[model samples]
Each structure stands twice: as structure tokens, then as C-alpha cells.
Target: MNTKKHWAVVVGLGLLTLSACGSSGGASATGSKTVTLVSHDSWAVSKNVLADFEKQSGYKVHVLKDGDAGQAVNKAILTKDNPQGDVFFGVDNTLLSRALDNGLFQSYEAKGSDLVKPEFRVDQTKHRVTPIDSGDICVNYDKAYFSKHGLTPPQSFDDLVKPEYKNLLVTENAATSSPGLGFLLATAAQYGDGGTSRSSEAESGGGWQAYWTKLKANGVKVVDGWEQAYNQEFSGSAGGKKAKADRPLVVSYASSPPAEVIYADPKPTTAPTGTSYGTCFRQIEYAGLLSNARNTKGGKAFIDFLLTKEFQEDMPLNMYVYPVREGARVPAEFEKYGKQAPHPETMAPTKIAANRDQWVKSWTSLVLK
Candidate 1:
């Protein structure tokens, strides 16, 4: 070969060698597909369930636990061009519109979307993502406090503002926390309506504004996150933690009841904590695939795993969220601590999506009083 041709041949051989080595390296190592699952903190499922997935699929499921759902989504969006995880979960209905708009999911229906709550099928893709579990953020009052103080549990969103309830409530900040936003949305849903068409009306009149003004006068307090509000403020059988000053009422999930019971050493036959009547707020959670995922197969598999009976039954005690499956088992503690509200109000996903950030921003300003 001429000198130029010899040089070209040598370069071609080097390229071929690199390609074969890369392919062989992938094939030889682990004999497994690594699926990265990015989810919010405290979203742990049953260990056996995940183990089963990793076992059956020959895919090692790597869970990348992040902070809040919003933060997780932000990270996913920033990496959308390159992509990181195979699936993303814990984007609730309140945050669904943003995830969808950002094109974070590739759609595929699960094996049993039919098993999901009928109302949850708002968007359908080949099962790109599916509903797993949900929780309600409600005013969790210490039964002991209310009874001892000779006060009644708060009945309406407006009731939190009453004189007797003064300075007892502590809640998450809506701007930073999912549960905080859930509480805010619950108030918006209960008094007015929260959908796309109507502007959220919170004037000095008879509504959320009026409710908040009363709560302010009643000595309502705000916290940076739910952990502070629950683990610190809410008095439960999980009672080793000291209550923060002026924090008798907390905003927490309904599933907290069961968790308090099961996790307590010497597992209480009955829940150690009691709930407020008609004081609960509802917040439905959701799961979705990343807009750009490297392993769509693993993404769908993970979601499918969540909806299974094993995962569903274990959810209440483990994660403190109600499984979307109609007949999932709930822990006794959850039944005790978590309340199925006498009259739970809900905001549609679309309405929540539209007004969420705006509502949070507005509430931060409004509640500064």
C-alpha cells in the first residue's frame, strides 16, 4: 500500500479495535442493565418488591433518592437533553402538568391501568407512567391537646382561625414543600374551586383570604418543611421528639397514623396518636416516566412493580401513602392516625397545575400577616 493508504488502514484498524472493546466490555460486565430511578425523599417501597424487580428483569434497579418532587423534576429537566435515570416517580397530580409539559415522559400503559382509580387516567401513553399511591395533607391536631384544652377539632378550613385554635398550627411552606402546597390547594379546593377556568379568588371577603386572616389571628405558624412540622410539631406515639413552641397542630399525611403504630417498638395494638375530625386535606400523588429515558423498559417495569399487590399493601405503613389500587391493605396504625375525611375536597390536576406556583407565591405574601 502507498504511504497514505497504509496510514488510513492503520487508523481504520484502531477504530475497529476500540469499537469491539467497548461492545465486549458492556457484554462481559455484570450481564445486567442498570436502571436508575430518581425519586423524592421518603419514597421507599418494600425491599422485597424492588429485589424482585431486580431479580426478574436482570436489571439492577438503582434508586437515586433526591430531595422534594419539585427538585427531582428540576434536575430531570436540566438533564433532559442527555438524560440520567431510566424512570422518574413521585410527581403528584399537582406537579403532573409541569412534568408533562416539559416532555419528561414517554408514554406506555401499565399491565393494569384498569386497576388504577378511574379518575387518575387523565393522560394515557403506552404506560409511560402510572398512578402508584396518594396521600392527603390534613390538619393533624393532637387529640390530647384538643380534648385537654376543651376545644373541638377544626371542621372547615375557616375553623383553623378560631380563637381557641390560636397559635397552635404549624405548616410547611408552600413554595418549597409538596405537602405545603397540598395543604394550600386543599384550602383553595374546599372554599372556592381550583381548575383552569376560574381565577383563584382570595379577597378580604368570605374565602381562603378570610380563612387565612383568621388563622393568622389565631396564631398560625409556618415551617420550612414537613419533617419539621410532623416529626417536630405533631405529637404522636413517636413522641420522643419535643414539640416546637406553639405547634400543637401540624400538616401531615393521613398515612401517618399507621406508620406511628407499626414503627413503634412493641408495636401498639392500637395507634398511639389520634386524628382531628373533618380537619384533613386531600392530595393525590402520581408517577410518570422521564421525558427522555435511556431505558423505557425498566421505567415501565418499575411503575408496574409499584402497582402490584405486594407494593400496594406495603405502601401505607412503609411510605404513609394510600395505594391507588382499590383494595390495598392499610396498616392499623394508619387507620388510627390517618383520617379519611368526612368531607375531603379535591382540586383537579389541571387547575392545580395552573395556579400552583402562583398560589404558593400569593399565599406567602398573604400569610405574612
Candidate 2:
């Protein structure tokens, strides 16, 4: 969900009014009719769909596009006492605990909570956040690069450490990017926490830390965020093509191939990129009413509107994420090119929260050093 910013084509939606502001600015004044929504840069909605919400609810929506998901969440936490907007969106499962621990949101059960898929729901008792969309953070390969090199793209995490695939992969910094953290968590899930009780040949007896060490040895490149990894380093993306990027593999979304196809000029008959489904981690994004919001009522209404069928159905192209609402229809391109991973690696939020900080510290020492 964080790297959804890679789909740059959908970002220019003229109908939705936006304010490019940081968390410290652009907050709505008290008693104002405008309800501001602060989110990561990828947020988008069709003009008519957003118009429908405003016309029906009589509350004008003003969106503030913060940086990426990680940056936005950190900024929101710093400003929780005086938030930038009424509602905050783009906090994903990877960072949900941080926001919750800091008391960034006030609980409010959305109107159509029952419609959300059961698997995506979390914090059921508190209702501090509402599940909005889900996607898989995965490794994407350049089709042409593999074909031209007579190289079979790496399929799984283990394959990456093999000699043949060395120097062909790039990923974001785990401490600063959602997809990067997801990939790190995926390895931690695949190989247990290096405890003696879970020793196995697949884990190489040292667990995720060992895995990352091997990945670093294999020449995996690390960038600051998804945009740099996908658009500037990955060979298959549209931005990468213009930039003449050389890395054939990048950590991005399963939905990336469809976005490539859909945005190409003369739309390709088939996607130029493909996902390595084996190297995927599930990611779920959420939205909530910011604590100390000026327009509590408007914030509640907007959160409810997000669960509506119209908004859910409009998400695929706009945000490149799957709606969490059951029975929501995805675009044809998504179905054909970006089917969800059958068994994406996942870790419980509790496990992630308990170990995330240490893992990042270890990762920085092992990989970035």
C-alpha cells in the first residue's frame, strides 16, 4: 500500500481537491464546513465519486498529501496533539502499533464495518482504525531483461541468495519504507526467530538475521523508499525505462504489472513486468479519525463513506490496492495481470510490534553497513 505511489499515472485526478502540505500545516479551523483528510501521496479518488460524497454529506473534502506512508505516519504521531486533519489514512499493519501506542487516533466504528473481509479486520475491540485496502509487497521482475539474458527470474527468497541472481535486486530501506519492512517481516516469518527450538536447514540455523546477511552478500541494493527502488532502480517500470535503470528485480507490489500495462502509451498487449509470487508479504492499510480533530462529526462521516461500495469499487485504478470490502469488484487488468499471491508470508501484528525495532536495528547493521 505504501509503494502505491509508483503508479504515477493515476495521481493527477483533477476532480479531487488536494493540498500538498506536511503534517504541521493545512489543518481545518474549528467549526469549519471543510473536513480535511491527511494521507500518503498515493491517495486518489474519481471526481464523480468524491463529488457524490460531498454533495450527499454537505461536507467539503480537502486532502493533504503527505510524503510516503512511513513519513506520513511519523509526522502524524509527532503532531498527534494538534493533528493536520480530521482523518488520517495510509497507516498500514507494519506501523499500526506505533500509531496506536502513541494514541494517534480516537475510536469510532465505521458504519459498514460488517462488510469488510474478516481476514483484514484487526483491533476489533477498540475500533481505533478501519481496514480500507490490502495488497502484497513482492519482488517484480523485468520480463525483457530475463528473456534477453537467458536467465530465469528468481522465484523465491532462497533463490535470491543463489550466485546466478547476484547484483540483480534492489529494495527499499526496511526502517523507512513499508514494503521494505514487509519484506524483512516476510523473511522473519519464513525462517523462525533463530531460536534453538525452531532450528532447521532452511533457516541455516541463524534465522532472519542470517538471511539478510546472505542477501547483502548476494549484492542486494537498498534505497531510501519505494519510489527510488522501483522507479529509479528497477529495470521494468516506466519510470525506470526513462531513467535507464538496470536492476532487473525490485521490491514492489503484486499489483505493479497491471499498473505498467494500464498506463503504457498504446497499452501493451501484455504487461512488461511480472511478479514473483513466492516472495510476497501481505500488507493491509487503514484509516482512522485523528485524535483531537476539530470536525469529529465530519471525520466520522468521511470514514463511513470510505466503506461505501462506490468508493471500494473505485480504488483499484486510483490507488492500485484491493478493496477490503467484500464483493468489491476489481478492474479487468488487475484480474488478468496482478492476481493476489496464494500464500503470502505474514506475521501477527503483535509479533511485528514486539520485534520490529530490534530487527530494523539488526538489519541496518547487517545490510546497510
Candidate 3:
């Protein structure tokens, strides 16, 4: 939430809007070949990276910024029969099943798909989507606030519900936010939810759902989305510079600290915040060709470009995500201040796909009721 001025400048690129309705079946508005990428609003890359793609592929790239991850996916599904963009980017593993179930994407394995780490790969056999970059959702605490109050920062998910920590934590609602859903899955992984055999009934009074009940009782605050939870509620976020939030801890990314240092007004000598990785959730974002794309050849080329060293390396400072390509170099800021959770919690895409809706429903009933 406490984004640097430069980061604000990065997102200042106005959202691109296209008149065409389907992925590639018709000629472009200008009657030229083009690859239109429909992605969440958080997407950013230097102009040069895009220019390079255009130079090599000879197809103009048009990026249409939908809202958040959920909003983007919903739009894609709504436009499925006709299609709105050539490729869909930003569907993380948590929402991968939703896209797959709707038949929104066609398989196109990138040449570089094999370069990705095994853990980051979600759709292996089908190759419906290619892994691009990853981000982790974890609890971030205000160093100044914790130090001022002489309270030790929370180290684990279990620590957040302690009496001393009550009312000090804030997070987005799982039903409404990507980070929220990842956190929900993290809890499920940590506490166990009967491991695929047990039905939703087994989850109600035990495992992750039971943990949510405890968190609700402990006075944890929930917001509608990440911007509200991080910027308006978390004491350590950029909004705190002008108007501080009441809560000192918030659900945010491990890369947030590096972002803070990189974007600081006076350039902080050290990071002003720290992350709690005890139960962090790893979220791998992906790119895929739309099933109805008119330019299937162009879509394949664009998806392949996404997994290349050039595109993957541009991600760190520009978008603040780890490159799925193993040897890609990260910015010095990330090397110094970023926290890569050594043992982040993860679940299989199949299992997550099967249980996601039910898990979200049960979570809502327990925590938001």
C-alpha cells in the first residue's frame, strides 16, 4: 500500500482499451495483425521490453487492463463465446481451475516452459497456461509501531490469534481478494483439511475453518480488498505517511519491503517493515492463449515471449514478482530487502480446484458471519 512515487509513475500508464470483442478472429481496428493481451490492472513493463517483442514477432501488442484478478477472469468468461483478447494473463494458481473449468483457454506450451521450476508449474500435462512469475502473500508488520509498543512481531499464523495480538491484525476478505484467497489456502495447508478424502463436513469444526473461527473471535479485521486492507488499514503502508491506520499488521507480499525501500521519499536507510513467512502462500501468475483467439499463431508467440529471460527479468522492479525462470536475475533491491519464504505453503492445482468454492463458502460462513 505504501508504494513509492516511482512505482506510482510506473502504473501511471493509462489502461489500454480495444474496440474488438473477440480474441483474433477478425482483423484489427486498423486492419493489421496484432496480439492483444488482457490482464489485471497491476501489469507493468518497460516500453523497451514490449518494443522488443514487436520488433522480433512483427505483431503489434495491445494490452487491455481489466480490473483485479477476479474481475479480469470474470470478463474473460463473459466474453468467452466471442473473446475480447488474444491471451489472458494474471490468472494465478488459486483461480486457475476456474479458468480451466470454463474452457476459456487453449493449450500452447511455450518453448521455455521447461525452464520453469517444477513447483511453479500448475498446468503441466495440458499446458493450458505457462508459468510467468510468482508472488507470496504474508503478514507484514510496522517495525516502528512494534518497536514503539515494545511488542514482538508475530512470527506465525498461530501467533496472530494470541490475546496480545488481538485487534492488531488486518486482512482482505477471501471471497473478494487474491491475497485473501491465498491466505485462506495457506491456512488450509498449515492446519490440514483432511487431505482430499474428507468432505466439507470434516472441515467445518476442524482444520482451517476452525482456525478461522478462532481468528474471528480474536478480533482480526477484514476488508473488501488488498488496496483497502493495505493502504487504509495497515499502519506501515504508504497511506500511513499522510493518515496512519489503526492496525500495525497487514496481509501483503514478501516483496513489499523492497518496494518500500525502493520507493521511499527520503530513501530509507533500511526497510521500514518486515514480513512474517511462517505461513506464507505462494501465488504463481500465468499466461495462456484464449480458446477463441483469432490469431492462434500470434498468441503462441506472445506466450513464448512471456517465458523468455528478457520478459521474466523485467518483472522484478517493474511488477515486483519472482521470475519463474530459474536463473533470471533479480534487482539489487530485491536481493537486499526482499524475503523469499523458505517453506511457503502450497496445494496441488487439482485439489485446490475441487475444494476452492466450498472452502471459500465455509470461510465466509465462519469468519464473516
Best candidate according to TM-score: 2
Q: Compose the digit string of candidate 3's lDDT tens values, residues 1-369.
A: 112332321111111233334444332442236888888777888789989999998998888776667777777877877777788898888878878998999988898888998878766789888989888888999999999999999988888878889899888888887788888999888777734412242334478867777788889998887777776888887775556688898888898888888877888988988999885988888889998787888889989999889998998877788998979989988888885798888888888988888998888888888
The lDDT per prediction is 0.63, 0.85, 0.79
Candidate 1, residues 2-53: lDDT per residue as tens digits?
2111100000000011111111112113222777777666566567877887
Best by lDDT: 2
lDDT of 2: 0.85
- lDDT per residue, candidate 2, 1-369, as tens digits? 343345631111111123434544467453567889998788889899999999999999998887677767777887778788999988888878988999999999999999999999999999999999999989999999999999999889888888999999999888777788888899888876764323243555688877788888889999977778888899999899999999999999998999998888889999999999999999988999999999999999999999999999998888888999989999999999999999999888888889988888888888988
For lDDT, candidate 1 versus 2, the one ahead is 2
Q: After superposition, how far is residue 92 of candidate 3 from its true place, in Å?
A: 0.7
Worst lDDT run of 10 residues, candidate 2, spans: 8-17
Off by over 4 Å in 1: 1-32, 125-128, 193-206, 235-246, 266-270, 336-339
**Model 1 clash tally?**
18
Each prediction's TM-score versus the true structure = 0.82, 0.91, 0.89
Residue 77, candidate 1: C-alpha displacement in angstroms: 1.5
Over 4 Å off in model 2, which ranges? 1-5, 8-25, 28-32, 196-203
Output the lDDT of residue 314, model 2. Answer: 95
Of candidate 1, the 10-residue stretch with the lowest lDDT total is: 7-16
TM-score sort, best first: 2, 3, 1
